[model samples]
Target chain A: MPAGFSAADFLYILPELVLIGGAMLLLSLSVLVPRRDGLLLWTALATVAVTLVLVVRFFGLDVTAARGLLAIDSFAAFFKVIVLLSAALTLLMSAPYLRVEGIRVGEYYFLILCATVGMMFMASGVELITLFIGLETMAVSFYVLVGFLKPNPRSNEAAVKYFLLGGFSLGILLYGMSLIYGVTGTTSLAGIAAALRGQDTSLVLVLAVILVGAGMGFKIAAVPFHMWAPDVYEGAPTPVTAFLSVGSKAASFAMLLRIFVVGLPALAQEWSLLFYVLAVISMTVGNIAALTQSNLKRMLAYSSIAHVGYLLIGVVVRTERGVAAMLLYLGVYLFMQLGAFAIVTAQRRSDIIGDELKDLSGLSKRNPLAAFAMGFFMLSLGGIPPTAGFMGKMWLFGAAIDAGFIWLAVIAVANSALSIYYYIRVVVFMWINQEEPVGSPIVIGPAMKVALGVALLGTVVLGIYPQFLFEQAEVAARTLQGITAATVVGGQ
Target chain B: MVETIVFYTLSALILGLGVAVITTPNTVHSVLFLVMNFLCVAVIYVVLEAEFLAVIQVLVYAGGIVVLYLFVVMLVNLKRDPEAHQDPRRLSLVGLALAGAVLLELAGIVVYSYSREPSAPVAAAAASPVQGNVEQIGWLLYTDYLIPFEVASVLLLVAMVGAIVLAKREL
Candidate 1:
């Protein structure tokens, strides 16, 4: 019976089990201990940190766990680290913000942990149905978290729009899954690739690929499927928005890489073209639209879209270096994007509207540290020299060129130049534009400081010494290729 | 021949009810049509020898989901027709173009499959045709797909919490 349901199988999913256990425990504690505001936050952070340690301990030890539904290799370890770091940082940011926003419910932390667990599932899932369920779990949790500020109509609207569009996209993705399953009669990544070897491509399979691509495009906020991102990001709680933009986006990319690269290698030529078109349009559309945004959150939302464009080039290349570059870029993104949003969260108060561009006016005069950090984040996001974002762009564009997609590199470079204008505009408002600031020097709580400190350290360290993280990413990418190799051997 | 006749009759009923569900002006009647469509689809499943699926379809879709639909339709209390707000412009041409494209694609697939050489079936190894349908499904669900089944329960739990958190009048 192939050692079904053994103790070792349970150990493979220990991190997820810990998270779900922690989430449920917190759900109960929220009811039992209603007044302890910091209790849930601390517990959630500890849970994620513990999970991170377990994943790191198992890194590079290639093993498929939970009866081959989940992989515990370097690839999963790498993304587990990303998802955990983002979750921990978001929880840190959420503590102070929640207090200020009067969201006293401990279920807030519960939902965040649940979502993180879902993302962890997405990172490790080797089966299509498992990934789909993980995606839905994450999506459902986000639907609630986006509308966490129940009194705010914009939050409600964002939640409704996200849920409706998200459900529709899920349907499209399910249809694609069913079609693929119908054609190959398997939902396992290794099996799918094995079945596809030497099999002639058909029109229905192409259509399935497109449908699946479209669904992922929506999650990562690629253009033409990115209509919901800005509104959702703008209206969501800043910490949740940071989580969605970095954490959820990273998880989606991980799922995409698993499905398209490992499972559908035979269709690489077709899907890479789809990604190329998506990349070009996403970059162009995101940068151009961001130019006129007055809300800082909305501006960053568009900027995220543009960043997804640059990330797509890595997928288009379909090389190990390309995937490594993408993973590195995501790591860089987690720091800078979350750092920027953490600064925004620090400024939130009942008396002040913090997300407007004018809220940043004369920020340097008020809180120099905050302004300096925000300025650095904007610089990195714009891919300026000597920042992690710049290094990330270099790696991605270099990979594209190495793969002979010179046009993609050229377009990305042009888009980077175009992106600088808007990213720098935020800097200009913070430093040079001398309008009276709307709020007092925002109090940076201890938790916020910790979150900001970690983000800053990651961003600056990676920017200066990119070689270490790059090597780790390379290992992770190679682990992914190992799956394909195994599949090929199985086919033989 | 009798199986073919039953399949065609159920398919027509399902298709006709699906159209009625979308086109009907009255909200309650539309929901009723949807329930009929679900029941017809359940019957079609039965004809295909998927007895377990047919039972679940009738129970979950026709019985459970239809009740929920009726509750929502009545609770919303539509005073004015919902379709009245739609644009009055004659956009039928665009709809027709899209529908025609879909029709052409389906036709092309049918033609291609008919003309191509028959390939070996892929799933035959996974489940032997001699086994009972429900037993085969139950074995696979508990064995190969156990993790996803558990995760699906988590998803349902999250959805339940979401509905309560978002829809409840008071926090």
Candidate 2:
């Protein structure tokens, strides 16, 4: 509390402190008090809501704390809001599924909170070691959440596969960090940018970029590094799967942008080119792969990968509008993806695994509102008009084409068209399949109704009126530009 | 001259004790030999002036880890040979080849480091304001890296809680 970390520095990370303290309290209360899951859920939700308020309060502030290791700025606030919103939704969706599946909700909520804290740190951290720790914190929590249903063998398998792959990629990421540190002689992003400014790119620098990119690519489930995603996504609890796809992917993208744009702006040419290939391959492979999956979760997994590919196109353009486009799409994706997963959560019955395409049959006949929400989600995910997904992709690809990458935009549109087939498949199953339901009519809990209603509102309204999202995204993206121009140094 | 003799003498004892720890017929005796080996390693660390590492080597390896190993040995009580179940597709020869490759690589590293000229010390390391190595570590962990250090501790806490939850029979 004396020179380096003062009382005021704690004010900078007050949101994280609240989340971590809340998570620890939840875990402790679970152990001591035994079973008060409803109480714990309310507490967890309040904790996230409080943290959300705190993070949003810092939206326009450009402040750094912990001696430049953490920066609570507009960019961080944007992603922190995304992570917190998804965590809250995931918590809401988890209650009903846990009750139906007979899993404990206490540790489940704690894991979600802990992972949220990790993502917050990932967004705010400006130093490599801090960011890596943040990454591992989130990853380790997901690994446990994935394998949470101990009696289920598929969950067990998914946990092991994810842990092994996650640990290996962490090592590669650290190796890249070490190489870059050796070259630039600093772990701070601004320091690295300063060190590498006007310098000739070397082989080791290129290798470091690739290794770091690949490690992040795995987190985001990009092509060639996404072998574990389908299995892990399918095996994980449906709510956990939703959180992983949305929160983890967004946090990883935040880290990726910080490293590439803020840290290595001097070598943007190298990374943009690398991500160009990854974007093309990831989109093509992910969309094409989603076509054949019978299980709804696996299909969404592939589709999320394809979405990341689209997001990468925004990164490739490297303009403020491009970054804004990426931010805008991720913001919309938060709603559509989670809205889709909420339906899957609702469909989970006692006797039946509700993720199969056939499980969606007769849903419209059973509950028309849920059926409509599912169809709306699927249409949005496919980038149809009058939805947020269309606006997101339009701005993203429009930015790419505006930057003179007409071919990239064309390929992207073609892929979006190809992606429609699978997206329509979900709608077709819900709306067209006339078979009786595999299980009884789904009875979504009050909490889940709130989550679904929120997601639905976000997807529909954000699409119909994109002005609010665009303005916030433009502000956030421009904040990153400000961060680059002066480049934070010697925080005192 | 005296330090050299002591270093070599301890090194030989370590190697010989390591071999005996593996070959001994009795589990208790093997564990005792392991403790002795760990103690010798700690002594070597002390001789090299890494007092913190030496203390940690004794406390963690010799004291804590061996106790866990001993507990496992006591509980498992393997009556049959542990290696009796050999799979038909076991690639022992391939494993041996890989081990040999690693050994060769280590030898290459030793040869290369010894042959190469020692570069001047890195001038870029920001000079630590603290004096001692341990003090510097403490200072940094408490100050400059306080947030990261705390986050890492939280990581460990989550991992511990998660492992327990996953292994729990009932909540």
Docking quality class, candidate 2: medium
TM-score of chain B of each: 0.68, 0.60
**lDDT measured at residue A184 in model 1 versus the true structure, 0 to 100:** 91
Look at candidate 1 and tell me the lDDT of residue A337.
98
Q: Top model by TM-score, which number? A: 1
**Candidate 1 chain A — worst ten consecutive residues by lDDT sum?**
A483-492
The per-candidate count of clashes, in order, stands at 0, 0
Q: Tell me the deviation in Å of residue A311 in model 1.
A: 0.6
**lDDT tens readout by residue for model 2, B84-157:** 34652454664466446435543544454446554443442245665543565677788788888999999998
- Against the true structure, whose lDDT is highest? 2
Residue B146, model 1: lDDT of 86
Global CA lDDT of candidate 1, please? 0.87
Cα displacement (angstroms), candidate 1, residue A116, comes to 1.0
lDDT of 1 by residue, A241-270 (tens): 999999999999999999998999988878
What C-alpha lDDT do the candidate models reach, one value each? 0.87, 0.88
TM-score for all predictions?
Answer: 0.91, 0.85
